[model samples]
Target chain A: QQQVKQSPQSLIVQKGGISIINCAYENTAFDYFPWYQQFPGKGPALLIAIRPDVSEKKEGRFTISFNKSAKQFSLHIMDSQPGDSATYFCAASHRSNDYKLSFGAGTTVTVRA
Target chain B: GAGVSQSPSNKVTEKGKDVELRCDPISGHTALYWYRQSLGQGLEFLIYFQGNSAPDKSGLPSDRFSAERTGGSVSTLTIQRTQQEDSAVYLCASTLWGGEAFFGQGTRLTVV
Candidate 1:
């Protein structure tokens, strides 16, 4: 079963605008939620993450808004740039468990110039 | 290698042949993980090893897939009797205990 589900398999946003990607999880035991950004022919890189203890986390231009009760989280890019065009994956893991991350189907984001 | 390193970035193997992929974790990183990326599907967890603990193989797709970690640093994934459906990019990641993981350029495996 897919533990995590992401919406908008692909997204296109204008430069200098906001870009958002949303994800939901079925496993309530997950405590850590992280987003990864991947470019073509490259590995996924950690973008932003949030714990169940916080409702929102902001890291510069990247922000993760997590709703613990809803088991949903979203990534928002402020002032999206062409350079930010890439694939984004949302993942979840439990800190005390095997630490294996369950990932979403991934969203391909395009920032139009 | 300064980062997580994977050997044989691309491998083209015949169906029914056996193949082995290798991964070298970052220095001082105690946690190592393997994941597979396929078309449309996202990263699928394959296995994980943390320090000296027993490895987790629950995510393995079938009995044909196996992995082992030696000296708590390097790992090898072996597939027996390759199939075309096995084609995918295998990714390796490592991290300090409870820290964010760093990934390596994946090994693209194509079975013909």
Candidate 2:
């Protein structure tokens, strides 16, 4: 069963625009949420992460907005650039469970120059 | 090494054959993980190894899939009687107990 769910399997945006991806989960045990960026034929890399303790976390132009009670989280890319075109995955895990990660289906983002 | 290294970045195998994929984790990393990604699909957890404790094999699809970590550093994922459905990219990752996970490039396996 898929523990985490993501929307917009694919999206296209003009450069300098905002790109957003949303994810939700039903497992309350999950406390750590992270986003990953992957290029073609390459493994996914960590982009940003957030804990339920915080409502939002931002790194550079990337931001993660989390809602603990709603069990929802979203990634927002500000001024999306062509280089940001890639697959993004949202994952959840809890520290007590040996950090066993549960991932959502990926979203492929395309930024047109 | 600076990061996790996986051997034989690509592998082509015949159905019914057995294949082994290797992963070298960064030194001192106590947590290791194996995940599989099919074309245009999400990653599927395979297995996990942490320190000297027993590995978690609950994610393995079947008995045909098994993995072993030697000296808690290098891990080998073996698939027996490869099937066409077994073809996928096998990715490895290593991390500290509570730190970020660093992933390898992954081994793309094609079972013909």
Candidate 3:
């Protein structure tokens, strides 16, 4: 079963605009949510993460908005740039148990300059 | 010395052949993981190794797939009698305790 689901298989955003990607999960036990960015020929790197206790977390230009009741979370990139073009994945996991991550299918983002 | 490292960036093999992929986790990291990425697909969990704890093989797709971590540092994934559907990019990641994971470049395996 796909525990986590994401939308918009691909996204195109203009430079300096906002880029958004959304994800939802079915497992209520998941308490940690993280977003990863991956460029071609490279592994996915952690961009930002949020816990269920917080409503939102921001790091530099990247923000993660999480809704605990709804079991959903999203990543928003402010002032998008061409260098931000890459594939993004959302993942969820529980801390008490094994740290195996359940990932969304992924979204390919293109920031056009 | 600083990040997770994987060997054999690319491998092409005939069907029914066995293939082995290696991963070297960062120094002092206690958690290691393996994931698979198919074309246009998300990272699929394969296995995980924590300090001394039993490895979690629940995510493994089939019995033909197996993994082993030696000395709590390096890991090896072995695939027996590979099939075309097994072709994908294999990624390795390492983390300290329960912190964020660091990923390696990955190894692209193609089975004909």
Model 3 residue A12 CA deviation (Å) reads 0.4
lDDT of 1 at A79: 99
What is every candidate's C-alpha DockQ against the true complex, given to 2 decimals? 0.86, 0.79, 0.90
**Candidate 3, residue A15: lDDT:** 98
Candidate 3 deviation (Cα RMSD): 0.8
Clashing pairs in 2: none
The lDDT-based order of candidates, best leading, equals 2, 3, 1
Which regions in candidate 2 have their CA more than 4 angstroms from the true location?
none
Tell me chain A's TM-score in each of the predictions.
0.97, 0.98, 0.97
Q: Interface RMSD (Å), each candidate?
A: 0.8, 0.9, 0.7
Each prediction's TM-score against the native?
0.97, 0.99, 0.98
lDDT of 2 at B23: 99
Model 2, A1-113: lDDT tens digits are: 99999988999999999999999999999978989999997888999999898999999999999998889999999999999999999999888878878888999999999
lDDT of 1 at B64: 100
The stretch of ten residues in a row with the least summed lDDT in candidate 3 chain A is A93-102
Which of candidates 2 and 3 is the stronger one according to DockQ? Answer: 3
Considering just chain B, what TM-score does every model have? Answer: 0.98, 0.99, 0.98
**Runs of candidate 3 exceeding 4 Å displacement:** none
**Candidate with the greatest DockQ versus the true structure:** 3
